[model samples]
Target: MEEMECGIEKKAAAMAAAEEVGRKEEAAAGDVGLKELSRKLNDFAKARDWEQYHSPRNLLLAMIAEVGELSELFMWKGEVRKGLADWDEAEKEHLGEELADVLLYLVRLSDICGVDLGDAATRKIVKNAAKYPAPSKEGA
Candidate 1:
């Protein structure tokens, strides 16, 4: 069944990517929430007749495979950390590109399932704010 349509702007996506994460309370750029990204994903899959193949089970596998490809960037089993931490200037850049491959699949998958990662993260933060109640040095 076709899900409810959400208007996610590309400009919003760019803005969110550009915005600083540690800044003060903001409107949350990248208005293109999970639902929006999913819609885009749907289009991509449909064009290639791939949606029929994207069962919940298979989607999980695809995600895993892409993740493994990403992991190849740092599978030295040596002193290196999980990512490009050990590499010099040139290799680190190569690792960065590999990381993008992993993220692209994740984004596509999230888009297919209507997962607005940013919105979801924000909502979770709000929930945590109420539950955790951070220790304030001085009462406001």
Candidate 2:
């Protein structure tokens, strides 16, 4: 009985660790601001002497390629809303990898161009909000 209890405890601990990993992966993409992400990407590229290959044009092309790859995952699949969970594990993993590639290239490009992506995104959001205000009850 004691051995069985120990086995169950081990299983519970393993399950908890798995859950934590899943949560971390779920929150991996959007949590970091562009400034921090760009700094990390810049350091990574510098460490590898990859800065030479990271000109804005090259980075932009790489980013566009990744975006195309990501889009291909949903190609001909009509109306992708709320159906991501229906995808197989390999499909989902590929999607995430392509997304990461796009983001890394974009950050590298922004760093090379000295663009403050976070501030630019914030300003664009404000501009968009002013251009498309919420509909009031009177409009309804």
Model 2 C-alpha lDDT per residue in residues 1-140, reported as the tens digit of each score: 99999999999999999999989966885677787788778788889999889877888998999899988988998887685867888988888888888888887888799888888888999999999997889966
Candidate 1, position 37, lDDT: 52
Report lDDT per candidate.
Answer: 0.67, 0.86
Report how far off residue 38 is in candidate 2 (Å). 1.0
lDDT tens digits, residues 1-140, model 1? 12322234656666787665524224442455555556667787899999788766677687788678767766765567665455788878776667655665677756556677677788999999999998997966
lDDT of 1 at 14: 62
Best by TM-score: 2
TM-score of each model, paired residue for residue: 0.51, 0.72
lDDT of 2: 0.86
| Candidate 1: residue 74 lDDT (0-100) | 63
lDDT of 2 at 26: 67
Poorest 10 consecutive residues by lDDT, candidate 2: 25-34
